[model samples]
Target chain A: MSKNLVEFNNISKFFGSVIALKDVTMHIKKGQIMCLLGDNGAGKSTLIKTLSGVHKPTRGEIIVEGKKTIFDSPRDALDLGIATVYQDLALVSLMSVTRNFFMGREPMKGFGPFKTFDVEKANNIASERMGQIGIDVRDPSQAVGTMSGGERQCLAISRAIYFGAKVLILDEPTSALGVHQASVVLKYIVKAATSGLGVILITHNVHHAYPVGNSFTILNRGKSMGTFEKKDLSREKLLGMMAGGEELDKLEVELKEIDRTLKN
Target chain B: MSVKSKSIQNKSKDERLRKVSRLKVLLNRPELGALGGSILVFIFFGIVAGDTGMFSAYGTINFLEVSANLGIIAVAAALLMIGGEFDLSVGSMIGFAGICIAIPAIYWGWPLWCSILFAFSMAVLVGYTNGILVVRTGLPSFIVTLAMLFILRGATLALTRLITGRTQVPGLRVLIENDPIAWIFSADAFKGLFSWLGSLGIIALRQDGTPLATGVPASVLWWIGMTIFATWLLMKTRYGNWIFASGGDKLGARNVGVPVGRVKISLFIGTAVAATIYACVQVLDAGSADTMRGFLKELEAIVAAVVGGCLLTGGYGSAIGAAFGALIFGTVSMGIYYTDVDTDWFKVFLGGMMLIAVIFNNYIRRRVTENK
Candidate 1:
C-alpha cells in the first residue's frame, strides 16, 4: 500500500516560451500537512492549477494513490478525490449555508422525475460537520453572508471533506482573514490533517505556515528550493529562505545606501 | 480527529443550532414586500371602487386577466434576474412569436396547433442564440438582449409588412375554431364551477342564465401553474441551487463545479419560452396579431420583477413575489378605469411603487445579512 496520497514527480509546465513551473517535485501523504510557500508569481498558482486538473504538465507525471493519473479536465481530478478551495471562490454569500455547502452536488429525495432537494437532511449534515470543526452554526438556513470570514472558510473546507476529498489544496485561505479568523482557520487545518486527509496549504506567510506545516516546499521563480521536514527547519531559517535570503541581503544593502543619502 | 474534545475548550460543545422562528422565516421571505403590497392594493381598490363593480366576479376576472398576462412573463423574468441576466427582447419576442403563430395558421392554412408549436420552436432557437451570444461574447446581458430587442422588433415589422402588405395579421379566430389545444389558451377553464357559483348567487350573472364571467381565463391558470413550478424549481431542485450560485458569484460557482454557463443559458431559454406563451394567449384572445402588440412589455415585466423583490444586481428573488407584483400592476392599471382617477396617473403610480419597492427590498436584504 502506498503511504503517499498524491505525488508530483518532476513536473514541468509551460505556456508558449513562458515557463510557469520547472522540475518541481512534491508529495502529500496521509495525515500530513504539506505547505507550499512562495512569493507572488513564484508558480504557486500554476502548480495548484496543474494539480487540480485545470492545467496538465507539459512534462513528467502525476500519481494519485500510487496510480499514474492523466488529468484531462477538472472533473477528472475531482473524481480522484482532489479538491481545491481557491480564495474568494469557495462560497456564495447571497445563498444559505446549506445551499453553499452542497452547491454542485445536491442530495435528492423522492422518486423518478418528481425529485426534490432534501433540505432537512442537508441542513443536518452541514450543521453537524460545521459543529464537528468547533463552529456552532447559529442557524443552518442563515445566509452565508452573515457568517464570519473564518467560519465561511471552515464551511468551504468542511464541505470539501464531506464530499469525500482525500487531498485538500487550499490557495491562500488565510490571506484575506483577520488575526483571530486566521488562527481559527489554522486550528481547523490541523484538525483536518489529524483526520487522515492530506492538506496542501499554499501561502507566502511563513508565520501562517510554520506552526501548522509538517513539511515545507518553497517555490522561487518557477523553481523548487527543495523540501524540508519540520524537525530539520527552524522558524527563522524558514522565514529567511522563503523571503529569498540572498535577495534580501542585497536589498538590505541598497536600502542602507538610500538611508545614508537621506541623512546627507 | 477529536477536534471538539481535544481543542483547547474555550467554546462549549453543547451549543446547538438556533431554531428558526416562524416570524423570522416570514420576515426573511423575499416575497414579503410583494405580498404586503398586493394586499394593500386589493383592499384600496375594494374600498375606493366597491360600488363600481370593480370587485365583482366579472370585473375581478378582467383585472386578473391583465395581471395573468403580465405575470406569465414576470415570473420568468424574475428567474432570469435571479440568474444574473436580463432579456430585453421579451416584449419583441412576444410580438414576433405572435406573428409566427398567426401568419402560418391564418394565411398559409396551417393547423393552429402546428403554428403554436412552430412559434415555440422559434422561441427556443432565438433563446438559444441569445444564450450563446451572451456566453460566447462575455457581454453584459443588458447590452446583448437590448440589441435583440431592436432586431426582433424590426424584423417583426418588416416581415409582417412584406408578407401581408400591412403591419397586422388578423383571422386567427377562425383558425382556432376547430383546433384541439387552442382552448388551453382561451378563457374557457372552470366553466362548470363558474356556472354553479353563478346559479347559487355567489357570483353575479347577466341575462340568459349565464355568468358574466364564464370561466377562469387559461392565462390565469398558466400564470399560477408557472409560478408554482418556478417556485419549486428555485427552492426544491438542484437546478434551482445552480441558478442562485450562478447569479451570486459566477466564478465561484464555476470553481465549485456548478455549470454556471448552462444555468444562465437555460434561464434565457426559459424567458423566451414564457414570452411565446404570452404571445399565444394574447393572439388567441384578441383574434389578431399586430407588430405593435406587446410594445414596452419587456420593461413592464422587469419592473414587476423588481417590485417583487428581485435584485437588479442578481442572486436573490422569488416567483411568487413576481406574481404578486403583476397582480398589483394589473389591479392599479385596470382599477383606474372604474374610478374617477385619470388613467394617466397610473404611470406615476408605477414609478412611485417601483422606488418604494426597491427601498423596501434594500432594507430587507440589509436586515437579513446583518452582522451578528
Candidate 2:
C-alpha cells in the first residue's frame, strides 16, 4: 500500500464552549486524491485549519510518514512538505505573477547586505512552471488581478507543485468558480494526484469530486459520517449520504405535495 | 503526425495572442502617473514663470531645495503607507527630536554627536511604540498615530517651555559651528560647482559681486541617496515583496509566512528615524529648535506620497513616484512666487493637484487591473 502522507488520528478541536470539530479521522495517501465532502457549517474549515497548522487540535495527534508530529506554524507545516491553497489562494492581486509565485520563498543573489531578489531566475521559473500547468502567461510581470479566475487557480496550483509539495490541501478551490472553471480545476487535481502527491480536496459538490477522488470522507455538523473507498460507494449512495438520507426523502415528499397543490 | 503539427501551431498562436506590448507594461508601472504629472507640472510652471528666472540655475536650485526637504520625509512616508499604515506623528516627531538634540547640546553641555544619538534613540522608541500599539491592539494606525501626533506636539511645547521658559531654543549652530559632524549634516558639498558657474556668469551673483550662496546642500544629496536606496529596497529585495504583500492583503500575506506584523513595525521605526534625520538637518542649518518647527509636515508628506501614486488604501506605490511628487510640489509652490500669482493661491493649487493626481491614479489602476 502507498504510504500515508498525513493521517489525523481522531483529532478534536474546541473553541471556548463550542466544538468546531469532533473526533475526525481522515488520511490522504501518496498518489491518491481524498475528497473531503461536507455541507456548509460541517466543520470542514476547522478540520483543515488543524491540518494546515493554523490551529492546534485540542486532542489527538497528527501522524505524518508513520510518525506523530506537531506543527507550530504554517511555516513548520510547509517545511514538512505540506502546502494548503485556501479558497482565496493567498495571492496579492496587485502584485505580478512572478512576485506572487515566489512571495515568501523568493530566490536571492549577491552577498550579505548587498543581497537582492533574483528577478531573472524568478521570472523564468514562474513562466516555465505556469506553462507546464497549461497557463500561457504572456508576461510574468503582468499583475495577477488581470488573470481569469480559472487562470489564477491554475497559478496557485502550479505554484504549489513547483515548491515540491508532498501533500496538497485545496480548501474549496472551486467553490467560487464557474462550471467551466471548476472543471478546469478538477483536471488539475487529477494531474496533481497523477504526479505522485497526496491531495485533500475539500468541496460540497459530489460531481466535481466523483470524477477525481480516489476516496471519500463525508462530514456532517462537526462529526464524520463515514469514510468510503471508490469501489465501496456508488455515486447515488454518496450523494444520498451527503444530503442525509432520511431528511432528503422527507424533503422530496414535501416538495411533491407542494407541486400537487399548485397543480390543483 | 498531422495532429501533432496542428497542435504545435496552435500553441505558438496562443503565445502570440498573450504577448503584451512594451508600452502597455510601462504604462502599468505604479509610478507612471506620478512621472507624467511631474512632467506636466514642470512644463506649466516653466511656461508661466520662465522669464522670471524659474528656468534659471538659481530658480531650479530654489525649488530643488524645497523639494529635497519634503522628499526625504515623503519617501519614508510612502514606504510606510505601502506597508499598510500611517504615521501622523512624523511632523511632531520632527519638533520633538529637534528639542531632544538642542536641549541636551546647548543646555546640558552634551557633545553634538551625543545629543544627535540621544534624539535618534527617542525617535526609534516613539516609532516602536506606535508600531506595537497598532499591531497588538489591532487598532487602526491612523488613530494611534493621530494620538501620538497630539501627544508629541503638546510634549514638545511643554518640555521646551519647562527647560528654557520659552518656545524656541537657539545657539545650536553656534555651539557646533566648527564641528566636523555639523559639516556632514548641514554643509554644502558642491560649493566649487556653484562658484565655478558664478565665475562663468551662468549663475547670479550677490550684491557684493561674489557668488550668491550656491552649492548642493547635503540634505539634497541625502534625499537622492535615500530615494535610490528606497527604490532598490522596494524593487530588488525580498523584504520589498513582503511590504507589498502585507499592504495588499495582510491575512493573505500571513498565511503565506510573510511576517506581516514585523514588516509593519519595522516600517514605523523607519519613518520615525527618517523624521529624526530631517529634524537634525533642519536644526543644524537654522541653529535652533522651535515647538512649531515642523507643523503640518505630516500632511504635506502624505499628500506628496498620494500625488506620487501611492494608494491611500496601501499595497500600491513606488519611492521614485513620491520623489517626483515632491518635485511637483516644490516647483508649484515656489514657481507661483515667480509667476506674480498671489502666494495664497498656492494652497488652492496644491488641493487641485492632489485631486487630479488621485483621479488619474485611480484610472490607471483600473486600466492595469482590468486589462485583458
Candidate 3:
C-alpha cells in the first residue's frame, strides 16, 4: 500500500455561529487521486481551505507524513509540499506566461544589489514544463489572459508540480470549462497522480470524478456521507446519493403530472 | 517506421508554431500605441511650426526643457499607477519641499546641504504617512492622497508665511552659486558641445555674440538617466515583478506569497521622493520658492502617464512610454507659441491628444488579444 501523504483526522471548522465543516476525516495516499464530491454550500470549500492552510481547523489535527502539523499560512502549507490551485488559478492575466509561472518565486542572477530576474531561465523552464503537460505554448512571452481556460488550468497544475508539491488540491478546476476542455483537464489530473503525487479534486460532477478518482469522499451540508473505494460505489448509486435520492424521485413525479396537465 | 515519421512531423509542426513574426511581436508591446502617437504628434507640430525655428536645434532644446521638468515626475507616477495606486499629493510635495529647502537656507541661515537634507526627510515622512494611511485604513489611495494634497499645500502656505512673512522666499542663488552640488543638480550639461555648435552657426547665439552655452539642462540628463533606470527596474528586476503583480490582482498576488502591502508602500515613497527631486531642481534653477509652485502639476503627470499607455486600471504601463508622453506635451505647449494659433487653444489640443492616445491604446490591446 502507498503511504498516506496527508490525513485529516476528525476535522471541524466553525465561523462565528455557523459550522462550515464538522467531524470530517479523509486521507490521500501518494500516487492516488481522491475526489471530494459536494454540491453548493456543502462545506467542500471549507475542507479544502483547511487542508491548504487558508484556515485552521477549530477541532482536530492534520497529520502530514506521520507527524501532527499546523499550518499558519498558505506559505506554510506550500513549504510542507501541499499546494492548492484555486478556481481563479492565482495568475496575473496581463503578465506573460514565464512571469506568471515565476511570479512570487522568480529566479535571480548576479550578486548583491545588482541581482536581476533570470528571464532566459524562466522562459525556457516555463515552455518546457508546459509542453510536458501537453500544452505547447508557442511563446513564453504570451500573456496568460490570451490562453484558453483549459490551458490556464494545465499551466497552474504544471506549476504546482514543478514547485515540488507532494499533494495538490484543485478547487473546481473543470467547473468553468466546456465538455472537451474538461476531458483535457481530467487527463492532466491523472497524469499528475501517475507521477506519484497525491491529488484532491473537488467537483460535484460524478461523471467527471468516476473516471479519474481512485477513491471518493462525498459531503452533504458539512457532514461526510461516507468514503468509498472506486470498486465499492457505482455511478448510479453515487448520483442517487448526491441528488438526495427520494427527494429527486418525488420531484420527477410532480414534474410528470405537471407535463400531462399542460398537454391536456 | 510509421511512428518514427510521425514523431518527426510533430517536431516540425511545433517548430513552425513557435516562429512569430517581428511585426506581431512589436505590435504586442504595451508601448506600441504610445510610440506611434508620439511620432505622429512630433511630425504634426513640426510641419505647423517648421519655419518659426520650432524644428531648429535651439527650439528643440527649449521644448525638451519643458518636457524634462515634467518627465521626472511622470515616470514615477507611471510606476505608481502601474502598482495600482495614485499619489495626488505629488504636486503639493513639490511646493512643500521647495519651501522646506528655501525657508531654512535663505531665511533661517542654515547651510544649503543641511537644508536639502531637511527637505528630503520631510518628503519621506509625508510619503510614509500617505502609504500607512492607505494600507492600514483600507481607504482608496485617491482619497488618501487627495487629503494629503490639501494638507501639504496648506502647510506650505502657512509655514512659508509664518517664517518669512511672505508667500515667496528668494536669495537661493547666493547660497548655491558656488556650491558643487548645485553645479551637478542645477547646471546646464553638455555646455561645450552646444557652444561649439553655436560657434559653427548650427545653434543660436546670444545678443552679446557669445554662444548660448546653456546646453541641455541638468534636469533633462536626470530625466534620461532616471527613465533608463526605471525601464531597467521594470523589465529586469524581481522588484519590478512584485510591482506588476501587486497592481494586476492584489488578492491573487497575496495568495501567491507576494507582499502586496510592502510593494505599495515602497511605490508611494518612491513617488514622493521623485516629487522632491523635481522641487529641488525648480527651486535651484529659479533661485526662489513660491507657495504656488507646482500647482496642477499632478494632473499633468497623470495625463502624461495615461498618454504613455498606462491603464488607469493599473498593472500595465511602461516608463519609457511616459517619457515620450511628456515630450508630446512639451512640444504642443511650446509649438503653439511658435505658430499663428491662439495660445489659449493649447488646452484644447492637449485634451484631444489624450483622448486619441487612450483610444489607440485600447484598440491595440484588443487587437493583440484577438490575434493571440
Candidate 4:
C-alpha cells in the first residue's frame, strides 16, 4: 500500500451556531484516488474548503506529509504543492490557453532589465502538457473561452499537473459534464493518480466514485457515516448506508399508508 | 477518434475564424467592425473633400501629428480600461504636466531635458497618489479620478496665477525662437536620423550636404516606438495576462496569486506617463502651456480608445486598436478642416463616431458569442 500523504484528524466546521462538519477524520494515501461522498449539505463543501485552505476548521489538525501545517491562504496551500481545481477553474476565458497555463508564473527569457515572458517556452509547454493528458487541442494559442466545458476542465487539470501539484483537489469536476465527458475527465483523474499525484475526488455520485476510488468516506448530516477502504466495504453496504436504507424504506411505507387513508 | 470533431464554423466574411482562439477572436474581432466604420467615414470624407488637398502631404502630416498625440493618451487609457478602471484626471493631468514643464523651462530657465524630466516625474507622482487612493480605499476609480481631476485643475489655475501673474501662461515663445533642443522636440530636424528610419534603408543624399528627405518629427517617431512597445507588452507578456485576469475578475485573479493591486497602480502610472509625454511636446511646440488646454483631452482619449474597440466594462482591448482609433480621429479632424465644413461642428462628428463604434462593437460581441 502507498504511504499516507494527507490526514485530517477530528476536524469540525461551524457557521454561527450550525455545525457543517463534525468529528471527521480521513487519510489519503499517496498515488491513491480517494472519493469523498455526501448528499446535499452533508459537509462535502465544508470539508473540501478546509482542505483547500478556503476555511479554517473549528477543531483539529490537518497533517500533510506527516507535518501539521497551517495554511493562512490558498496561495500558501498552492506553494506547498496542494492545487485545488475550483469548480469554475478561475480561468480568464479571453486569455490564450498558454497564457492561462502560466497565468501568474510565466517563464522569463532575458536577464535583468531586458526580462520578458518566454512566449516560445510557454506555448511549447502548454501544448505538451495538454497532449500528455490526452487532450488533443490542436493549438495552445486558442482562447480558453473557445474550448468546450469538458475541455476547459481538462485544461485546468493538465495545468495543475504541469505546475507540479503533489495533491490535486477537484471540486465536483464532473458535476456539469455529460456521461461520456465525465468518463473522459475521470480517465484524466485516474491518469493523474497513476502519474504520482494523490487526488481527492469530491463528489456526491457514488457511481462515479465506485470504479476509480480506492478509498471512500461517506458523510451524513455533518457526521461521518463511515470511512472505508475498497476492500472493507461492499457495494450493497455502501448504498444502504448512503440512503439510510431501512429507515428510509419505513418512511416511504408510512407515506403510502397516509395516502391510502386520505383516498378512503 | 475523439468523440468531438464537430467544429462550429462561422460563415461570416472570413471562414478561417473558426480555427481562431478566443483571445485572437476578441482581439481581431473589434478590428473588422471598426474597419468597416472607418471605410464608410473615409468614403464620405473622400467625396466631400475630394478636390481639395485632403490627400496632400501637409494635410496628412497635420492629421498624423494630431493622431500621434491623441493616440498616446488613448493607448494609456486603453490599458487602464482593459484593467477595469477609468481615470477622468488624465485631461487635467495633461494641463498639470504641461504647466510643470513650462514652469521649470520658462520660469526657472532650466534646460529642456531637465524641465521635461521634472514634469514627467511629477506626473508619475500624481499617478501614484491616484492609484493608491483608489486601490487602498476601495473607492470607485471614477470618483477617485474625478476628484483628482478637479484638484489638479484647481491647483494648475492657482499655480499659474501665482507664477505668471496671469491665468494663461504664454507659450514657450522664448525657447522656440532660441532653443535648438526645443526645435528638435517640436519642429522637424532637417536632413537627420528620422528620415533614414522612415525611409527604411533608402538613403537620400543631396549636393548641399542635405538629405533628399527630411527627418520625421521626433513626436511621430516617439509615437510609433511607444505603440510597438505597448503592443508587445500587452500581447506577449505574463503581466499582460494578469492585467486581463484582474480586469475580468479581480477576486478570481487574487485567489490565483496575482498581485491585482500592483497591476492597477502600474496602469495609472502608464496613463500619467503618456499624458506627460503629450504635454511636453505640446508645450514645446506652442512655447506656452495653455491654462485651458487639455480641458477635455481625457474624454477624447477615452472616446478614442472605446472607438478603437476597447470595452468600457473592461478586460478586453488592444493597443493597436487604440492607435487605429486615434488615427480615425486625426483624419476626421483634418478632413473637416479641409472641406468647407464648420470646424465647430467637429464635436457632433466625434459624438456620432463614438456612438456608431459602440453599436458596432456590441454587434460584433453578440455575433461572436451567439454560438456559445
- Please name the candidate that would achieve the greatest TM-score relative to the true structure: 2
Model 3 segments more than 4 A misplaced: A243-246, A253-264, B1-12, B15-20, B178-180, B207-209
Segments in model 2 whose C-alpha atoms lie over 4 Å from true places:
A256-264, B1-19, B207-209
How far in Å is the alpha carbon of A117 misplaced in model 2? Answer: 0.3
Judge candidate 2 at residue B260 and give its lDDT.
90
- Per-residue lDDT of model 1, residues A140-189, tens digit only: 77889888889888999999889999999999999989999999999999
Q: Judged by DockQ cut-offs, is candidate 3 incorrect, acceptable, medium or high?
A: medium
DockQ per model, Cα: 0.59, 0.72, 0.59, 0.27
In the range B133-238, model 2's lDDT, one tens digit per residue, is: 9999999999999999999999999999999999999988777776757676788877888888888898888887667757878888888998999999999999
Stretches of candidate 4 exceeding 4 Å from the true structure: A10-24, A40-43, A54-59, A219-226, A234-254, A260-264, B1-29, B35-47, B104-115, B137-140, B162-165, B171-215, B366-372
Candidate 3 versus the native: TM-score? 0.93
Q: List iRMS (one decimal) for every candidate.
A: 2.1, 1.2, 1.7, 4.6
lDDT of 3 by residue, A37-129 (tens): 988899999998899888999999899999999999999999999999999999988888998999888999999999999987887788779
Ranking by TM-score: 2, 1, 3, 4
By lDDT, the candidates rank as: 1, 2, 3, 4
Fraction of true contacts retained by every candidate, in order, equals: 0.70, 0.69, 0.56, 0.35
* TM accuracy, model 4: 0.84
lDDT (Cα, tens digit) per residue for candidate 1, span B99-210: 9998889788889999999999999999988998998899999999999999999999999998899999988887778899888897578899999999999998888999
Cα lDDT computed for each candidate against the true fold = 0.91, 0.88, 0.87, 0.80
| lDDT over C-alpha atoms for residue B107 of model 2 | 92
Candidate closer to the true structure by lDDT (higher is better), 2 or 4: 2
Q: Which prediction has more favorable lDDT, 2 or 3?
A: 2
